[model samples]
Target: MTTILVTGGTGTLGRLVTERLREGGHEVRVLSRKAEPYAVDLREGGPALDRAVEGVEAVVHCASTPRGGDERAARNLIGAARRAGVPHLVYISIVGVDRVPLGYYKAKHAVERLVEGSGLGWTVLRATQFHELVQQMLSTFARSPVMVLPAGVADQPIEVAEVADRLAGLAVRPPAGRVPDMGGPEVRTFPDLARAYLRATGRRRAVVSVPLAGKTYRAFRSGGHLAPEQAVGKGTFEEYLRR
Candidate 1:
C-alpha cells in the first residue's frame, strides 16, 4: 500500500478524502496543527513540513485558509512537495476561480498556478460549491426572516463526498492537469436555494433577490462556476436537505 499525506484532513472534504484513501488500502497520514502523526501547518513553515512530505507517494492538498493566508499556505505546500520529490499533487479548487472577482477565488487561482508550474506532477479538480456550504450560507442569512440573495446567479452545489471521492480517484491515478470540472445534478439560483431551505425546515422566510453588479456578479450570472455538461454528482439539494 502506498503512503499518502492529506493536508486539512480534519476538515469536511479533507476528512472524507482521507477516509476514502484509507479504505482503498493506502496508509493515510493526516496533516493538522494538533499532535497527530503528521501534524503540519502550511502557514507555519518549518522542519515539520519537510518531514510531513517525505516518503509520501502523493499529497492531497485540501488545506486552505480563505479567511486569509491561502496563497502563502499553498506556496509552502508546493515548495515542500517539490523538495520531497513527491510524484503527484492533487488540488481541490473552486469552479470559476479565475472568472470570479472574489478575493478568495483570486487566491485559489494563484494556488492553481503554483501547483501547475511547481514542476511536480499535479492535477487540479475545480468543483462547484458544496451543498453544505451553500446551505450554511443561506441559513445564516435567513435569520432575519428575509433571505437576501443575489439575482441571476446560477449555482450547481455538489455533494462534498462526491468531490472527495473524485479526489480519491485522482490520488491513485497519474496526474492529469486540470481534469474535467464537476458540479451538482441541478443548476439553481440563489433564491431557489433559500426557498428550498425554508420549505425543508418548515421555516417561514421571504427570499429577496437583489441585482448585483460588477465583474463578480457578471461572472456568476454567466454561469462561469457551472459544469452542467459534467455534472457527475447524483445528489440534489433537496435530497441533501432531507438528510
Candidate 2:
C-alpha cells in the first residue's frame, strides 16, 4: 500500500477520490482547510503543507475554488510536493481551460503549466464540467419563475464519481503526462438541460436563452469546452436527475 495525499479531499470530487484511494488499501491523507490532521489551507502553504506531502507516494490535486486562489494553492502544493520528494503529482483540470477565456479557466491553465514543469513525474487529466455544477446552475435559476441560460452553448456534463474513480486509479499508476480528455455520454445544449431539470423536478418554469456577449461566452458557444470525441462517461444528465 502507498501513502497518497489528496488536496481538497473533502470537496465534492476530492471526497470521492479520497474514499476510493482508501478503499484500495492505500493510506490516504485528506488536505483541506478544515480536515483533521491536515487542516492546512493550500492557498497559504507553510510548514503544515510540507508535513502533508511528506512521505506520500503521490498527490492528487482536487482542491480548487471558483471564487479564486487556485493558482496560489497549486504553487504552494507543488512546492510542498517538491520539498517532500513526492514521486507523482496528479491534477484534475477542465477540458477547455486553455481554449476558454474565463478567469477560472486561465488560472487552471496556469496551474497546468506549473504541474507540467514541477520536475516531479506528473499526470494531468482534463475533463468536461461535472453534473453537480450543472445541477447547481440549474438550481439557482430554478429559484425564479424564468430561467435564463446561455444561448448556443452546449455542455457535456460528466459524473463526478466516475472522475473520482479515474483519479484514484491514476494516483497509483505511473505518471502519464496529460491523459485523454474525459467527457459525458452525451452533449446537450444548456436550454435542453435546463428543461430536463424542470421535467425531473416537476418545476414549472419558462426557460429563456440569452446570447451572452464576451470572448468567454463566444468560446463556450463555439464548443471550445466540449470533448465530443471523448464522451466516455457512463451516466447521462437525465439519468443523474432521475436519481
Candidate 3:
C-alpha cells in the first residue's frame, strides 16, 4: 500500500478522503494544526512539513484559506510537495471559480494556475457548491417568517460526500490534469431550495425573491456557478433533507 499525505485532513472533505484512504488499506497521514497522526501548518513553513510528508508517495492538497490567503497557501503547499518529491498533487477547486469574479474564486483560479505551471503531475477537480453550504444558506435566510432569496439565479449543488468520493478516487489514481466538472443532480433556484428546505424541516415560511444588483448578482443570474449538463451527483435536495 502506498503512503498518502492528506493536508487539511480535519476538514469536512479532507476527513472523508482520509477515511476512504485508510479503508482502502493505504497508509494515511493527516496534516493539521492540532496534534494528530501527522501535524503541519501550511502557513508556517519549516521542517514540520518535511516531517509530515516524509516517505509519502502522493499528496492530496485539500487545505485552503479564505479568499485572501488561498493562493499563498496553494503556492506554499506546491513548493513543499516539490521539495518532498511527491509524484502527484491533487487539488480540490470550486466550479465557476474562473467565471465568477469573487475574491475567493480569484484565489482559487490563481492556485489552479500555480499547480498547472508547477510542472508536477497534478489534477484539479472543480466541483459545484456543497449541499451543506446550500443548507446553511437556507437556514440563514429563513431566520424570519419570510425567507429572502436572490431573485435572479439558480444553482446545481453537489453533496460533500460525492465530492469527497471523487477526491479520494483521484488521490489513488495517477494525475489526469483538470478532471471533468462535477455538479448536483438537480437545478434549483434559491427560493425554490428555501421552500423545499422549509417543507422538509416542517417549518412554515414564505420565500421572498429579492432582486440583487452588482457583479456578483449578475454572475449568478448568468449561471456562472452551475454545471447543469455535468450534474453527476445522485443526491437531491429532498434526499439531502431526509438525511
Q: Which is the leading candidate under TM-score?
A: 2
Question: What's the CA error at residue 186 for candidate 1, in Å?
Answer: 0.5
Mark the regions of model 2 whose C-alpha exceeds 4 Å error after superposition.
none
Model 2: per-residue lDDT, tens digit, 139-217? 9989998999988999999999999999999999999999999999999999899989999999999999988898999
Q: Which stretches of candidate 3 lie over 4 Å from their true place?
A: none
lDDT of 1 by residue, 85-131 (tens): 99999999998898888889999999999999989999999999999
Question: What is the C-alpha lDDT profile of model 3 across 1-243, one tens digit per residue?
Answer: 989988889998899999989988999888987746567667775778878876788888888876366676667777878888888989899899998888888888898999999878999999998888899888988789788888868988788888988888898899899999999999888878887899899998877888988897899789998999899998888788899
Better of 2 and 3 by lDDT: 2
Candidate ordering by lDDT (highest first): 2, 1, 3
**Residue 92 miss distance in model 1 (angstroms):** 0.6
User: After superposition, which runs of candidate 1 have C-alpha atoms over 4 Å from their true positions?
Assistant: none
lDDT agreement of model 1 with the native: 0.90
What's the distance in Å from true for residue 181, model 2? 0.4
Please give the lDDT score at residue 43 for candidate 3.
Answer: 75
RMSD value for candidate 1 = 1.1
